[model samples]
Target: MWKFYLFLLPIFGVNISGLYAKNDQKIILATYTYDTKDRIENLLPFADLLKSRFEGKFEIETKSFPSVDELILAMLKKEVDLVFISTAGFLSYIDQADEFEIAGTLMVDQESESTYRSIIAASKLSGINSWEDVKSKSKGLKISLVNENSTSGYLLPYLHFQQRGLTPFKDNFGLVEFTGNHKKSLDSILTGEFDLAAFGENDLQNLSGNEDLIHILWVSPAIPLGPVMVRKDMDKSISEVVEQNLLNLHQSYPAILESIKAGWIEAQNASHFEKLTKDFYIDFLK
Candidate 1:
């Protein structure tokens, strides 16, 4: 698995302060999307930012993956050079030991604060108040989840249930459904079409005035927002250039930061992902 961050990461490599190397190759930059035009639009300017700094040497690209595995397949096929990917999507590709390294992490601000989080919520009508309630009543309640690729929407929530020996998949739940995205998942639960839903904390926050319609059952630990990823063998000069630009974006290029409501931070202090990664491989992925 990729270390995914660092002063230097234990498993991933970083060279922000190291000596540089120049490669003639034009660095490829891309972001993963779930067939959303909005996500494609958000990704469009990223290459422009790099191009401005690199004197027009970036190949702007975007890949739309219906699922996380497709993105991993693209990486395995060497079809991408750098990509913006969720923590779950990145770490789930366990065979990617040396092919890539985390170049940076996204932050909602200049500091380490990242608000990427998961929530397990119940319809007010569901009679489910907590994990214990869900466990005891798992057999008959319908549950909605965003697809498997989602970190805040699926992965962490899935692992949370798994840890307590309550596999929603095998518990004879009334219906286990993938709502495709967070908003739909919220919508399903809000209307009482589904008794439970798992999705991002921000999704509920974005849907104001609906608090009375839903009961909050659980919230996950802050998931590190997605990171910037690059090939491990990328030219040192290019890597340093990208890292420096990432570190400076909040200042030198505020619009880019604002576009995504997040800024790039140094690839440092990601030991938090270690346990998450380990548990995923040892427990969830199995």
Candidate 2:
């Protein structure tokens, strides 16, 4: 029997002693990444631009990590004051932080009513023609997924499989590898290294990939991109300033949006991003 368990992963980051100690004049913001070596560097100019909005009241420091675990640990230690994290982390890891407060959602633009979705993709090498083929033969199937901390890449797809009676990489699939990011997951499929890949649909349209050789077996609902998170305990004035800037990023600070390839949007009809998370009950044989 399969269940849709709430996604809670174990910690994998090493403890950095005294990380919480920082200069009082500096604020730290972080994001998790894999293979985007320049992500941190790209964020620097954005941080500088954001700092400019603070009127010399404080400085912004941007950092990137290869693992969500490390990012979360930094948050726990109060070393990271703000974050641009994935939806999965927002849903499952919020309680891990004492002051986590969602400030805004990251969108393609202010007018992007709908966000990205997840897909179960297969490459030509899999010899799987369609959804039925995957459903019938997914057992022992070699699947490639992004890191466990990803929402579209892992969590949504995890529920998609369980709701349909298939739990790959846990009980049924032969091989399941974490490719680190959406592009890498897609790449793994194209290279014929796996029978299936689970990732965001946005990558299919935005990324330059051999789409002709891939087959879409399934697609999850519009799981919005990650949100901008801030520690509620942060200085009230600074927090208010950061929140306002993020909400108006597309219109007020287009340069920051251009640098990151996306802008922030206020949740159109909601006070928070509660709908972005899925409740699961998977029992992972612990």
Steric overlap count per candidate: 4, 7
lDDT of 2 at 201: 71
What lDDT score belongs to each candidate, Candidate 1 first?
0.65, 0.65
Per-residue lDDT for 1-286 in model 2, tens only?
0011101101212112212333377778898775555367646766875566553446678888777777888878777888877667766666554467777765433324454678888988889987678777777578989888877889888888887778645677778888887888888888888889998776787556577778888876566666678886665555655666666566655566555543222122222222122222112101
How do the predictions measure up, each by TM-score? 0.77, 0.74
- Give, for candidate 1, the lowest lDDT window spanning 10 residues: 266-275
Q: Report the lDDT tens digits of candidate 1 across residue range 98-118.
A: 576776655443324544678
Worst lDDT 10-window in candidate 2: 1-10
Superposition-based RMSD of candidate 2 using all C-alpha atoms, in angstroms: 11.2
Q: Tell me the spans in candidate 1 whose CA falls farther than 4 Å from its real position.
A: 1-24, 57-67, 108-114, 262-286
Error of 2 at 47 (Å): 2.4
Model 2 clashing-pair count: 7
